[model samples]
Structure formats: C-alpha cells, structure tokens
Target chain A: MIITKKSYTFEVSPQSVDFNCQITLSSLTDLLLTAAQYNAEENGFGLRKLNNNGLSWVLLRLALEIDYFPLQYETVYIETWIEGVGRASTTRNFCIRNKEMQIIGYAASTWAMIDHQTRRAQDLFTLDNIGDFASEETVPIDKPIKLSERRGVLTDVFSAKYSHIDINRHVNTMRYVEWISNGFSPEHYSRKSVKRFDVNFMSEILFGEEVKVYKTEEAGDTYLFEILHNDKPSCRARLIFRSEK
Target chain B: MIITKKSYTFEVSPQSVDFNCQITLSSLTDLLLTAAQYNAEENGFGLRKLNNNGLSWVLLRLALEIDYFPLQYETVYIETWIEGVGRASTTRNFCIRNKEMQIIGYAASTWAMIDHQTRRAQDLFTLDNIGDFASEETVPIDKPIKLSERRGVLTDVFSAKYSHIDINRHVNTMRYVEWISNGFSPEHYSRKSVKRFDVNFMSEILFGEEVKVYKTEEAGDTYLFEILHNDKPSCRARLIFRSEK
Candidate 1:
C-alpha cells in the first residue's frame, strides 16, 4: 500500500466558518487550491519566493463525499496529489482525515493552468515545457454528474484570504460550501432550508484568490450554483431549498 | 447601542455538529476564543507578532445559551465587549444574530492572561491600567450547562496551524469544530455515534499560536475535552457518545 507520509495536516477553528458549524464550501475550494500549493511547493512550483510569480490554479468542479463530520479544535490532514494532468484539464484529488488517518471526507477537483498576471487559462499542453509541474499518466477523471439529473444553485463567488491556505494543503471543501452558501442571506435560510445540495468538487482554489460564485435558481424549486475560477467553472452545486424560515 | 463598524456574519454548517446538527461543544469554546481576540486586539494586545513579549489569553470558563439553533450559514454576529479586567481574569460577552443585527445567539467568556513562553497565568493586575477590553457593565452571563449534557469525544491532543486565524481575530469556531470532530477515527465514529455536546466558549487563540486539544473519554458515554493554549486551558467541553458506527 502506498502510504501518505506527510498528509498536510493543520488545525482550524470557528471563525473559519460563515455562520455554519461546518467549514464553508468556498473554504473547500480554498483547500483544493492549497492542496495544489502543497503539491506545487513540494515540486518547487508553489508561491514563488522572489519574483512572486504566484501559481493560481482554478477549481473546475468538486465532488465531496463525507461520512462523518468534524468539530472545532480538531486537527485534520488534507492528503492530495495530481492523479495526473490531461490535455484540457489537470485533475487533482483530495482526502480529509483525522489524526488516526481515517478518511473522513474526500474531494476531486479539476484545475487548469493559468497565467497569474493576465488571469488567463494556460493550455496545459503548451506549458509542459516552461512550468516544472507535469504529470505522466492521467488515470481517471471524475465524470461530472450528467445534466439529466438534479440542478440547484451552484456556488458562485467566494471571498478568500492568505491564511485560508493550510500548511496542511488546500483550504477544505466545507469552507467552499460555507462561502457559497453565505451568499444567501441567513434570514433567507431560516425562511428557506437546504434540503439537499449536490456539489461536484472539481479543483482547488488557492488562498487570496477572489472567486466568483454564480448560481441560477432553476425552476423556482431548486438552484444550480457554480463557483468559477474566472470564466472556467470550479465547483458546481445543486441545492434544493425549502421554505422553513 | 455601540455598534462595531467592521462586523462579519456566519452561516453555521453541518460540519459544526458532531453527528447531530447542533454545534459540537468544542465550537462554543472557539466562539469564546474568537471574542477574546477582538477584546484583546481592540486594545492593541492582539496575536503574537514578531516579539517574544506576547500575551496569550487563556480561557477560564464560558456560559452560553442557544435560544434557537443557528443552522448552516445562518448569519450571526459575535457582538462582544469587555466587562472590565479582574485581578486574574478579563470578562467578555457576545450576542449572536440571525441576519442583519438580529440577535439569535448569546455567550460570555472569562479569560486569563498568560505569558506565552512560561505557559503560566500572568498577573492581570499589571495590565490594570488598560482595564478590561470592555467597560465593566453588569452584562448577563449564561449559566454553564452540565458537561454530561453535551456530545462527542473528549478530544485528544491535535496539532493546528497559523493560517486558521480569520480576519475577525482568532480561528473561527466552525473550522475548529470541523477539525476537532474530525480528529476521531472514522471507524470509531461509525462504531459509536456522537449524541450531544455542549462547549463553553473560552479564550481566543491567534495566528501562529500552537495549541493542544486534550480529551478524556469516560466509558464511551461522555468525553471531557479541553483546548489548551500553550498548555493553559483555553476552553472546556463535554461530549456525549452514542452506540453507532
């Protein structure tokens, strides 16, 4: 078994969340972003020292599956790696665990190479020569859930900071949910409850990267939300809201 | 009414809970910690920055009341003020909100100033000239609930990071809950479910602060937990475990 040696772990607290006990979803995007940073730093491609030629990896989508949740003061580890990069999108994966290293949650994100200054998506194939970051076998891609199924509000934009980055890697998916969900007024939430939210996690969003979250309330019953790394989509979510508050 | 100009809100999430939607007892401790940061920072006694001469505020106790459960992303404010500095402790208070200025939750915390290097309680009287973070007004303090009434694990020592700090001041409460709750083994949680937890919000832990979470499991029924800042108790909590996996 290929064991994870340093599964970037760190502690996070309540101020981390919007109003929710869970980590915010956008924070999740930030986590994915940090995971990329960790991977990049290990490969000498993360936040560059002198030039400040930062690496900004945009989240394409995120698919999160959680078994049990965590509480405040608990320390967690985010283990991630490049499943491999492809011609179009670079696929990254994540797993959140406890001190015991038990998998508490997992996420899969799709990222695209982008120019830091221009804020333009760089073609992965073209950048293989310049950037030291490259992958050999692009194993599997987390297939985006088909359009025929359910659609809710996808998280649109997220406000982030440098601290959101974990020394521990990636911001954490729950933070993304919190940031995206926070867009909606809490007063509205009490009046409206989230029944089911389907968030397909794609890639990671780094710290201090201001992300725009877009959501199209579909059919007046559910909403389809998308968190974008500029024009490229990062995470798409479908939320079923109820009138409770 | 004195209002804070730079106010932030929150949307509580599922991650804040143990297995139940209720916030983990640990989160209450985080809330207290967060408020303490504000109380300290407003007076220029913020987090440890550059110098060894830093004051690490430790939590003594907390009394909180949840009038109505604050759900995920339910916008709430931790409106806080100091109630003067005692010989050993600084009193802090907070009120939660649902939306814009809507009171939803309320809490109060007592903090002890300590020397970061020595890890021993400091003389609050020395800072007497500064007085408490807030004026001494007889604000109501919530009564502490029985520790047995709470749920979750007596958390064990867990490592944390500096980036966990938020713009507001300390580590957000939700992130703490998420990580701390995640500290337990997935198998342990899958085997024994979290029933209930009640935490007393304590003192704040700022950036670059390394803290330890100590837990004591009692017969798998309840766990006594404490988040120690530099070995001094920052917060206290009680968690209830259930028969589930």
Candidate 2:
C-alpha cells in the first residue's frame, strides 16, 4: 500500500524571497501546493491520473498562519496529509517547520475534484480508495472561514493571460495571491507584514477573461478582497497584517 | 578566497511544470536566476553586498537553447560561472544537465552594474577584485543576438502593476517573457515548443506605467517581439519554435 502521509524538505531560494529577504506569501503557497501534489501522487491519485479520467483537482479555500517567514537559503520542512475526505470535497493540512524542526507555520486547504470538460464537481465516492489516504488528523488552526460577499470599491482590473492559466485551464492559485498583494503599494509593504491569510475560491476564472479586484478595509490592519469576473464573484480573501517593529 | 564557480541541483516540482508535464520556461528562468544569485553570494559580491554600496545588477541580455525540457520531479543540475568581465558588463554562462549527467541545455546572460539611486550604469573597473572571478570560459552556444528594432503588429497592452516590479524597483525580466509568451494562444502552444529564446533589455519599466507588446513573424519558425513604453522600446525578444511531432 502506498503511503498517504508525507514530508518534504526545501531550501528557500533567492527567487522566492521578497524585498525583506523572507519567503513571499506566494512562494509559501507554492510550497504547500507542491507538497499536496507530492502526497497525492504518492497515493496513486494525482493530477496525471485524474486527467486521464477527464477530471482535475481545484483548490476551493485555504487558510495560513505563520509565526516567522523563512529567509533565503534557509531549510524548510513541510509535513502534509489528508485530514478528511468528503462526498465532493477534501481537506489537506500542512505543518511548516524550520531547520530546527520547530513548527513555524500551519496551512489548511480545501479542494474539489471536478470534471475537466464540464467543470462540475465530481462525487468523491467514485474514487473508491481515496478514503484510505485520509489520516483524519487536523492542524491546530481554525478552518478556512467562508468569506461573505463584499461590495467594495474597485482596486484593479486585468484580463487573465496564458501565464495565469495552469494545466487544468484555470488560473493558478498563486496568481490570486499576487493580485491581492499587488493591491497594496510599496509604501504599504514597507511598514507591514502579513500575519494571517484566508481565501475562498468560489468559481473558476478562465484565460482571457477580465477580472476586477475589489477591496475594502474591514478594520485596523484587516482588509477584505473580492475578485469578480463579468460582475460575478469568483474569489474572496481576507488578509491580516501587523506593523513591522 | 571565494569560489567564482558554483553548481546547484534542483528537482522540478509540480508548480514548475506545464500542461505537457515539462518544466515551463518561466520556471527554468527562475532556476537560472536563483543559481546566479547563489554563486554571486558565494563570491562575496551578491546583490545584498552590492546594494549596501549603492550599486545593483541588472540583466541586459540572455539566450537559452534547450534540447529537451525536464519533467516534473526530475532532478537537474546547473553549473554557472562568470565567463568574462568587461568595462561595464559581465557574461555569465550556465550548463544544464539532467539526472543522467547528460547536457540538456545551455544558457548565456549579460549583466551590468548600475547605481541603485541613479539607475545609471556603473563602471565595472571600479570593483577592484571582480576581474579575479572571471573563468574566461564559454558555454559553446551562440551569443545573445542583438535584436534590431521591430515594428511588429500590436499584440498586448496593460498597465504595469506592483507585482511586476522586483526589489530593484523595476519590472522583472520574467514578467516580460510572460507578456511575450501570452501573445501566442493555447492553440499555438499545443503545436509548438520553443527551441531557443533571446531577449534584450534596453530600459526599465516602472509600476503603474502603460506598456505594449508587439510581435512579427521573421521567417518560417522564428518570431520577433518588442515591448514599448511611452512609444519607446523597453525590451525585445526573438523566439524560435519547432513543431511538436
């Protein structure tokens, strides 16, 4: 039997670092997604296998909390496993550790398997053995919160291009974080660092589709964002920041 | 004494692969840049050290030719060294090898030192010991072509956003590649793979500035691109593609 729980190690590279020399949020998301993919492949039901059956996996929601962001050239260990497998969705949890093996961050993500052609969620029951991989263990952080509708002011607008689309013909998750992060100016970043992040991916945005990002300040250091396509909500996010000392 | 040459190994992760399961050009470029930064730091003249002295390095031109793209999870090695140093710029060469130690690709790049504050090209001779790092070797590939001005048909237009700007406060080189690659649709990519690429950076693009991309067919399989800002050329590229069999 293939193992479902897996751990991977990586070194923070220069390309993944930001102006502050710490790994950027997008890079952190990439690392988590990479680990998820590795675990999926180890369980005999990866994107490659799903694509062969006219299906693909899509991230629906994610929440991350980091005590400290790793710096360039620092070693990082990510232990990931399936927390639960439901009828049409599943949850994956990650433990992010530093070189000292101390827990530095935790991330949890929700995903859905959808038909590649119809783009409709497929019943997870069809995958007969996927449940075998669920360890039923959970991260000690709150689950990704369901973001409510936000009718905020328009912050930016751009059409999805080739780079935004992934193999499944939808926008890459990190691109969404990039759009959200871009909502702030350099001056804003100079004084603040992200503490926690929550995002809900309600719908898929395809290539060449125009996307408008809306932003509103919910409270002190807390901002909410809604990404709309053709006036329909596609994704929502809430970001909490702390002033850098 | 610092080592002027360096070798690094990396595994092509899922996030770096494209629809064909081969590593995307953008990800490959990121790996190359990462290796360059690592080698520079090992030589004690990295971006951090240079920035401390009010100086920065900027990519001027790059050329890459690959025989086969690596697949996801495949191990690859990159060996890089400074080939030559001139009055104002230096040439860096890279050898890309697959897990079997077979050479798979070769890349060459030229970079210039500039004042961080003035953004003016700095005299390389002023860096007393930089000459000691030149290996005086070459990558056995054609040098990056000096692309002449091309008045191609308009392809894409957008305002440069904050995410496009790197720590140097200018648009990142990979962002330009994205724009140029997006000029071709998914249908185009389905039938062709890039055989070689050459890009030249003539000027820096700033945040929130309007930019346009133009493209022209040079011959049967060669295409030229030029990126303009305020009607002035910022960067140019030439791509040669081979029809996938």
Number of the predicted model whose DockQ against the real structure is largest: 2
DockQ of 2: 0.57
lDDT of 1 by residue, A1-245 (tens): 22221367655553554333345444444554555555655654443321144434545555555544454345778877665567667656676887678876666666665565665676666543322343332323343343232333443343343223322234445555655565565345436555444566555565445577666766766776666654455566766665653
> Which pairs clash inside model 2?
none
* List of chain A TM-scores, every candidate: 0.58, 0.96
Chain B TM-scores per candidate, in order, are: 0.55, 0.96
Off by over 4 Å in 2: A1-4, B1-4
True-structure Cα RMSD, model 2: 2.3
**TM-score to true structure, per model:** 0.40, 0.93
**Tens-digit lDDT string for candidate 1 (B1-245):** 33222244444443343322344445544555665565455555654321236565655555555544444334556667666677787766666666656765556666677775565677877663546245655435444453432233444443333235443345555445544464454335536544444555455665445566666667758667667666655556765666743
lDDT of each: 0.53, 0.87
Q: What would the DockQ be for model 1?
A: 0.06
TM-score: model 1 vs. ground truth? 0.40
